[model samples]
Target: MLNRHIKSHSQYKKHMCTFCGKGFNDTFDLKRHTRTHTGVRPYKCEICSKAFTQRCSLEAHLRKIHGAALHFAYKQRRDKLYICEECGYATHSQEVLHLHLQDNHPSSTFLRKASKKMEMTLQKKQGEDQTENSTADEGSR
Candidate 1:
């Protein structure tokens, strides 16, 4: 990951954007950068229905985009801003925050709990939708 991040900003830029001629050290960074000009956000969050060009950005959205009030409203608090209990580092992102936690506080179960909550929320919603569909089918018969 460090190599990829470093490669992205290194002086030996290899990949060049076709639209704006901007250069990048890595192809993945170049592809993500191209999305800016294209306005393409293929990655979508199931929880809040937000889209992002990169998976990392979408994960960030899942960690930080929604406020606490809105987060609770949508039951999407998993996407809310995360503040490190160990250090002062804060971000509205997931993978980065997870990395921070793993690096700083190895034994913390916060990430696991957050992930489980999000998964259970999604499962509950799916079950509700299935029940509604089944009821509608029975009514139609």
Candidate 2:
């Protein structure tokens, strides 16, 4: 085989944790993921004052509040989605999964009306389809 010099991340440093021996591409990621084992909360939400151990969780919260569609779009691209064991709801990211666990399985309150929106849209679309079919049948007759 000919020599193939495929370049990789030049500055990539495998930040390894001595406890688990797992490696990451970035030191910041290793620091952040280490909090899972340490049970540390570094980010706090200003709106609800809810604190999270991970920045990813905080980002997901903000995205859910301000960019739900964007977040959903990002989720559909995941290889395997995470489902809530408590409610069987699927999430693409760890943050949303954690949020679902907190909201459904723990002592947490919902700030958004997810069920109301889904119900209203479902009913409205059903009514529109029924009316359209009825009108089309009448016109054909």
Candidate 3:
């Protein structure tokens, strides 16, 4: 992490924001900064419907404003939220997002293709898990 931070300071910024021409060493930082210009607040509060550009900002809002406590196990990160770019719909599960896209935004070709890709990846992962289990079983026997 220290090395990454050091690299960010020393290295030339490769990612540039089109709106303001601000440069960032990291793509994630560039995207986050771009959101400030685009007004694309992806992270939203479920209770108040207030949105934020970053997930951490939303989490802080939930804790401070809504009096919500976010509990995570030691060294465990929060679940990656699947957010709908079309409607600001957010979910913890990709399967839920796939169903949401199918039901609400059937006309979205890009989202549909993304859902299919996710499904294919999941199927591949399941196949790999089964193969590993079978190999382990053979070795144990």
lDDT of 2 by residue, 36-110 (tens): 665556466777777676546876987787563334454455354443433345556645666676666664222
Best by lDDT: 3
Clashing pairs in 1: 62-79, 63-79, 64-92
Candidate 1, run of 10 with poorest lDDT:
67-76
TM-score of each: 0.41, 0.33, 0.62
The alpha-carbon lDDT assigned to residue 13 of candidate 3 equals 78
lDDT of candidate model 3 versus the reference = 0.80
The most accurate candidate by TM-score is 3
* Model 3 residue 28 lDDT score: 68
Over 1-141, each residue of candidate 1 has an lDDT whose tens digit, in order, gives 788987866787798888899889886677678778867666668888777766567667777765323334443345455544344455777557777777777776556754565568779999999999999999999
Give lDDT: candidate 1, residue 54.
66
Compared with the true structure, the alpha-carbon lDDT of candidate 1 equals 0.68
Q: How accurate locally is residue 5 in candidate 2, as Cα lDDT from 0 to 100?
A: 21
The whole-model lDDT of each prediction reads 0.68, 0.58, 0.80
